[model samples]
Target: MRRLVGVLVAVGLALGVVSAGPASAAIDSSGSAVILPPDQDPFYVPPADYGSRPNGTVLRSREITALAYVMPIPVHAYQVLYKSVDGHGAPVAEAATVLVPYTSWTGPGTRPLVSYQIADDSLSTRCQPSYTLRVGIGSPTGVGSYEVSMSYQALLRGYAIVYADYEGPHSQFAAGPQAAHGVLDGMRAVLHHAPAGLDPNTKITLWGYSGGGLATTWAAEQQGSYAPELNVVGAAAGGVPAELGAMLRHNNGNLGAGLALLGVIGLARAYPESGVYGILNDRGRALFATNEDACTLDVAVLHPFDRIENYTTIADPIDSPQARFLIDTNNPGQATPRMPYYNYEALQDEFVPAALADGLLKDYCADGGTVKKVRIPFSGHITGEVQGGPGALQFLADRVAGKPVTSDC
Candidate 1:
């Protein structure tokens, strides 16, 4: 715990909250200065005519040193800024980091691609995997940096991985369609890049938990329609908030309320037409302004057990017409995935109710979609990710091997 606190203090110092110094500066393995955060980086800016380019077209490319706890990993890493569509189908530039192992693949068929989504439950571009996975001072505090360790497991297995900033340029945290487009198009950009050396016919699988799970499931549901040219074999989503409204209600006025509020901000960013900001009172507006660029740790640590009604003008803002429309539009399970699906949930999840996953799987099965379900006993939202990860990985392995999946539904 002492070491953890020390790391947090160091992060605070780097963020300029505790002390002032050369912020956002860290030495890479090559002894060069690391790239600036996305907010301050020119690479994140897309060309004005990027909208005229095809979806998934690479706008910018840069080679980056991948890191694991400040040490450089022996792998080839590249970040691509690609064109994608937002929730309303407007052109937007999204970023993704593609990692290829130094070791060659000895597995069946060509090398497999795993689009691993990191749970970037933050409102800052600095929290995206494209920035966080690089060797830099900000990496320790970047939300995706910790989860990139799990992507290394797939890299060890000779699977090329792409970590997309599925939240898009604005960091729309819970907006589903925008995330889906970003994930699918990131895969497209990776395949289109010649230097990546990935086969165009690479079998793809998706894995993520919590907010990542939300993005993975959204991509899985929309892949058939949005990017049917790509070969997506299977997907594994755990600790999923399958229904946005249900999750908001479950977490309101509880320990997860701060995170829930972040989701509201994200939704408002994705759909300004919903008028979420207009409904906010002075306190709500102030809190939103403060946390608009906050990382997951900032929200989780600073605003636990918060009540939305404390800041909003309405007693039940979630039940308002705009909120209802946002919820209905973003919720998954309206369509079934073309490939096999694996879902895991915590029976006692506090942030997202298990019944939502249960109902989603049931609906998928009824729609003739291949589905696998696992329920972790005595686990809450966080522990469910740890306990369910191995099973999810195994399920992906079977799909990659072309093994038949048995649907529990």
Candidate 2:
């Protein structure tokens, strides 16, 4: 890997450039961010036997300082690359940042785990939690910063936190099964990471919001079938994009139109058989390619209020049979989670319709899952986090205390 990076650097020097255009900027790291060599870049070159390894098998681990943006925190941080599966059921390697709080558990049987998936809405390695959690490193969308701040809150409560990339090596951003596999395998990696001193049987809570909420919900729904042994106590997700079709339809012509476009790009990357690219016009292709390395802010700034229909050659790209099939396959709450759930949605959300989230809670209830649903009024997408976080934390606290959850469903 060093040799490969050296050659690339040498070539870049020959060409009088340090980084290679937008691809280099895609990860959105600072000038001081530790640059990995090409061969060693986990995002670029995964292990040859990636899918062959057992799920959750830790391929590599490196200790690093946990940071809240640029400031270091008193936590034991380990960056781990673990075995996971992709949308195609192929083996893939995923990365996550595990943080063991310096404080001890004063009120619990054991320090519970929080698989805190962040809203890393990007198809770039640089946006991965493991990368952005380092001091001086930042994601273009600032989502990483927000995630670290939230993780710090969990650290204060004596919970070990694992921030999984979830997007996998291919940066399959919105693929449900792929994200679930990455998150589950990430938990496996952290639990077995001896140095973290966590019990294998420790109870866990899956917590996330927005894009992370989508991944968290999927992980919760798949945990019974995929990682049945995990002692998950509850899942707390807010601002969930439960129905992709509804989200896309709502995002169209709204300020969040860029996210809708990016969702299509992500879906295409995850399920190429859907043939999204094949249906695209030249303008559509260019727009899609331009967003290949974009983060949240970039996407919104570049294509705010843009409609998905404007980019495709077909009358309605989202309703195409291939797209519909993939969307249905990825929608969450198909299976019942073995544990209780705390689902909250902003009634005024412009990105994901509140009705869709309500439907997800209803679907989970229908599947015999215990669900406590909350609707935060007067809150939109971004502000919903502030309004809903305290309630979610309290719910998670109750679970950590081994108290029985009172179901709203």
- Top candidate on lDDT is 1
Model 2 Cα lDDT, one tens digit per residue, 165-191:
899866777889999999999999999
CA lDDT of every candidate: 0.84, 0.79
Q: How much does candidate 1 score in TM-score?
A: 0.93
Model 1: weakest 10-residue lDDT segment is 16-25
Candidate 1 local lDDT, residue 118 = 94
List runs of model 2 lying over 4 Å from the truth: 1-33, 37-44, 135-137
Q: Estimate each model's TM-score.
A: 0.93, 0.90
Mark the 10 consecutive residues where model 2 has the least summed lDDT.
19-28
